[model samples]
Target: MKQDLRAVIIDDETNAREALSNLLRLVCPEVEICGEAKNADLGIEVIKEQKPNLVFLDIQMPGKSGFDLLASFEKVDFGIIFTTAYQEFAIRAFRFSAIDYLLKPIDPDELQAAVEKYKSQTAGLNPQQIQILQQQLDTPGTVRLVNRQKNDNQRIALPTAEGIHFVQMTDIIQCESLGSYTKFHLIKGPAIVVSRLLKEYEEILDNYYFFRVHQSNIINLEHIKRYVKGDGGQVWMSDNTEIEVSRRRKEEFLSLLSDFYVNSGKLK
Candidate 1:
């Protein structure tokens, strides 16, 4: 037998909190609502008192946002499921950080799915993952000025057999597909192999400087040392590894690289 999941709902809106509580009672009988709070300050108090296994946190509130509430804790021992009215960009950040979130006007199916995911996963979002999410949410500009702060802030969460690894996006040279698994070749460390499919990562990395030169390979444009031309050009990565660009994708890859150089001001 399993234990009931003790949960706390924290939202500024009374209706939102009530709605979520009622929905949980109906959809998730296994989840027990132990506490509720209207603001971050009261939320902190509720969490400390109840020490629930999970928290359904609303993103925007009167005094502090969900991110601010998380920052208050030195270590988050419980799981989190964020409730938000944010748009696509924030959704992308949540995906990139592997965090669980439900958009406003939450659908029952999605909420149930999120709960199932939480039950299956070993742990919830760690501090590093939260930081990555916050950073990605803060950065809205497509073309940002190069700086150490930006580089340090840009990280993605990779879940492996060992645990969830938070890595700087700039450190990744390329991603290689090994059947269902994806291996990350980094600039400063050994490759990290993740259980997820390559296509999933391709979608996330595409928003950054990554380009899929082949079906099995996605290279970071910043890590391209040289491009050797051929029927399908081969690019030498910063790791000194040569990767072949697919014949069908060669033209598009070149175009993207040219655009990258122009936009990045690296065309000297």
Candidate 2:
């Protein structure tokens, strides 16, 4: 028999908790509702007392937000599936950190997917990664990405067949689209194919100064070795991969290159 996965729902509203609990009851028979809490304080207490294996945490509460709740914990041992109302920034942040989340008015399909993802990530998160998630939430505005932090090891979480792997953003030379999957080429690692679209990764990596020179490719701006003008354009990547830029996207790519070079003081 499959063991029931214990879960606790932490939300500020009674309706929200009840709705999710009921939804889980209908869709997932393996999930056992261990307890529920109305706020982060009580949520922490329930977490300590019940010690459920999974927590469905609402991002917004009366006093302490979801980020605040996570900050309170010394170490997050169990799985967390965040529930939030749609904020463009929040959505991007979640993708950037590769965290599982359920949007408000949640669909059953998405709920099931989130649960499955949590099951796969049984090991959960460490303290520093958790802190980065907090940083992601607070970060939304676009700024020219610079390697200002000398000691910062900026990595993006990628889900693979083996498990979740964190790849340094700077190490990634380019990304290629394969229908629903996006394959990443890193500096010294084997190519990794993740179950996500190129556009999704493009959105998350663009903020970190990656550029989409083609519909099917997103290359790190710092990894362009040379550009050869063609019908549209061709660029040689640091790893020696050649990417094609569409004519329509050529101007945008050139402008981005201009900005990137100027920002990095490579161009006057």
Best by TM-score: 1
Model 2 stretches astray by more than 4 angstroms: 117-122, 126-129, 142-153
Write down the TM-score for model 2: 0.86
Q: Taking the tens digit of each residue's C-alpha lDDT, what string does model 2 give over 16-48?
A: 899999999999878999999999999999999
Error of 1 at 32 (Å): 1.0
TM-score of each: 0.86, 0.86
Q: Can you tell me which runs of candidate 1 are displaced by over 4 Å?
A: 120-122, 142-153
lDDT of 2: 0.81
Task: List model 1 lDDT by residue over 1-268, tens digit each.
Answer: 2367999999998988998988898898899999999999999999999999999999888878888998899889889999998887777778788887999888888988888888877766888888878877777534222321233347889888898888888898899999999999998868999987899887676567888899999998889999999999899998889999999999888888887787677894
Q: What is the Å distance of residue 89 in model 1 from its true position?
A: 1.8
